[model samples]
Target: MTTAFDTAARPAAVPGDTLVLAGRPLRDHAVLEETSRYAEDVWVLTPAWLRADQKTLRLDFTLVPPALVDVAKPLFLALLAQDTPPGELPLAIDSIRTYFGCARRFLWWVHGRDRTLRELDGEDLDDYHREITALRLSGGATRCNRRAVRMFWAYRNVLPDHLGQDPLRRSLWQAWARVHRRAGGENLTDRIPEQVVAPLLSWAMRWVDDFADDVLAARAERDRHRGPAARGP
Candidate 1:
């Protein structure tokens, strides 16, 4: 199955154009440009700002039924390219992957019934939400899944096919917090063991106290050898 953007409606990508400006901080107000090149099943984010490990975000349309890919691809691309006013900042690679995973779940579910995004109504969304709630996924997972559904409504203007109604505004979502909320306001991250933390703290303190002057003197000596040009204006 070949994938391509509708260039007649959207602008074509210029060679060497970047999704986000170089050195512009992520999640800032900087607006992301639409690129026709990203109309693919897999997008490898090679921007200089991204870490090497976080470069690939695959939206493999092949994983879903062929009927859904046409609508799904453009919607996912729009979500990726969305960073203008009223839209949130362009997602990091990991976040994009997460959203794709969440959206894919809905796509597969819809495809099972031989339906498309355009045919979906509020009842369909309610059913999807109920299915997610029935899955007994973690609070974070459930929230992410629901947010993925909401994205269709949130970026409705940009998407070729989208939810006509707001999924979150539905009365079914009113009890979301009570149903899926985690207890105790506890942090979910695992704490580092004392044995590991102790050695790390000792090394950090040694570097700050014992090696601080030696490191500063070495930098000064290196700068002195290089002369005023190394010191800069």
Candidate 2:
């Protein structure tokens, strides 16, 4: 499956159906503010997008939240606090922390930092943006924030004003460049302390691979010492 076709010769192409928006920092700008969890936010847009595109091609946005992963920490603790098998905890944490975690952090941040507790609507998200843009998010974190915020607003129910209805959300940037700069801002990915990749795998894949190898080697060595079993015994 890992086949490579010379991409340069194919004439670069950007999908018109794919619209990418930049994410805001969850704690966007302020150091004091924490990050958000946008775990369910991304999927929340599915129905709306389906209604919009219908055919030609399905449209989707892949949000990249730089520092939004910490949101999974609570989920991890939640799992640990439960009665799930200890053996299962590590595997669950691996997926929760690695795959959808950043988006989760973005959601956690906006819910926790930008909007006041118990209040999901009626706030000026733009000010929140200004605030987030000022603080330090880990690499590609800002995009996570902005994308989550926009998607959250897009999915949230709007309140009725005396005159009409207002949008429940806002966007950090209309284009991708600003988003890339803000989220991928600084090499924050590196800022996240390098971890040995194998050390992580050792907990599962490596250990199992090692155990199998040891078992096979032990059997071979025992057979070798037996001198072909000396015919019939």
Candidate 3:
């Protein structure tokens, strides 16, 4: 019901005279550079995010999509206000922020390099996937990249389900790159060796077991007047 960042969002408002916009008058490059930091601060205040580390703060700001950044300014500030000062933003809110930031970076290539989403065809998608591979994000961050792509396409589906970490499902993505001209990602066939996979899987299984145990432990106790049954006997 709450509209966090629905309408009003703005970066820190210094005195008008003290604020000096950088880069071209209309480019908004300096504003974006600072805005990225503002976004990072918001990330710091998120409970637990999809990204594993702080590298999201290092995202490229080449294009700074007008649609994304211009509106996001107000959206970002509004989200911060919802978090108040010391409290952390919820996980869903953090995921939304990551999705927005990722798409904003992707649009840089599509918009700044004079490439339209249509050009996602040909060899472009292949090259774009390569760039994503080079991004060096952790397992969780890679998941965020997939989420960004899902949003960029305006799909009603959540990326985690349709485009999970499972390498088997990735093959279907080629159609997206081809049809939307939005190139696909690097082949993850052997991207993650078993050495890494085994441990993650083990840890996840253990956590699931721990969760089930807690559920059992929380089972409610029923109190009754058994003395009445004994008197009847």
Candidate 4:
């Protein structure tokens, strides 16, 4: 029943106990202050700003099957801790939530089949890919799910229980990606016509060139009119 926060295996604080978070030196206390494990299966992560609408980014592992939860928790905890080596970065809360969705979908699929994650082989992955393809999900959605499955292999060294082999090492994946338009595909976003873009750019330039100075001056004047107490530090 040991949670991430109470785990004895948690890494000891490094020298100076400093973390470079959001381009600033964040002390250990500041990082822990924003993260809390409310239960064995739920973690609430708050960003520094703590916006009202996004007060917490909750990762609830209870949605994962009980048999698989032990294996899943460590992977997520490592990700939440941002334990990557140099040149790698931790995912933002929003990105982590997206990954969680992908992971949850895959875990539920495995659970439905009465399979354990550790027992998943490359063939099992291929069948899973076929299942995902059968769903007719958009190319992006399929890729996200595929990437989540591959994550178990990619981060295997960090996880106590992980896939024994690379899921993407097989040639079948390349064939699947090509056949499904999942690889080397151009962005499908509709480009705004030049006719529409030209007017928007012109209006933006006019605001910057003709109106920005006046707006800044008004703001400065308003700030100046405020008493020192009103502008208290």
Please give, for residues 50-78, the per-residue lDDT of candidate 1 as tens digits. Answer: 33244444556667667766556656565
- Residue 223, candidate 3: how far off, in angstroms? 21
Off by over 4 Å in 1: 1-36, 46-49, 52-56, 84-90, 178-233
Task: Score every model by TM-score.
Answer: 0.60, 0.26, 0.33, 0.60
lDDT of each: 0.64, 0.36, 0.42, 0.65
Q: Residue pairs in steric clash, candidate 1?
A: none
TM-score for candidate 2 = 0.26
Residue-wise C-alpha lDDT for candidate 3, range 41-113, written one tens digit per residue: 2323222222334323322333366533433333333333343222333224344556557666666666656
**Which lDDT tens digits does candidate 2 get at residues 29-71?**
3321122222323322122121223322111123433333232
> By lDDT, who's the top model here?
4
Off by over 4 Å in 2: 1-125, 157-172, 175-233
Those runs of model 4 whose alpha carbons end farther than 4 Å from true positions after fitting are 1-31, 48-56, 85-89, 179-233
Query: What's each prediction's clash count?
Result: 0, 28, 6, 0
Evaluation by TM-score, superior candidate among 2 and 4: 4
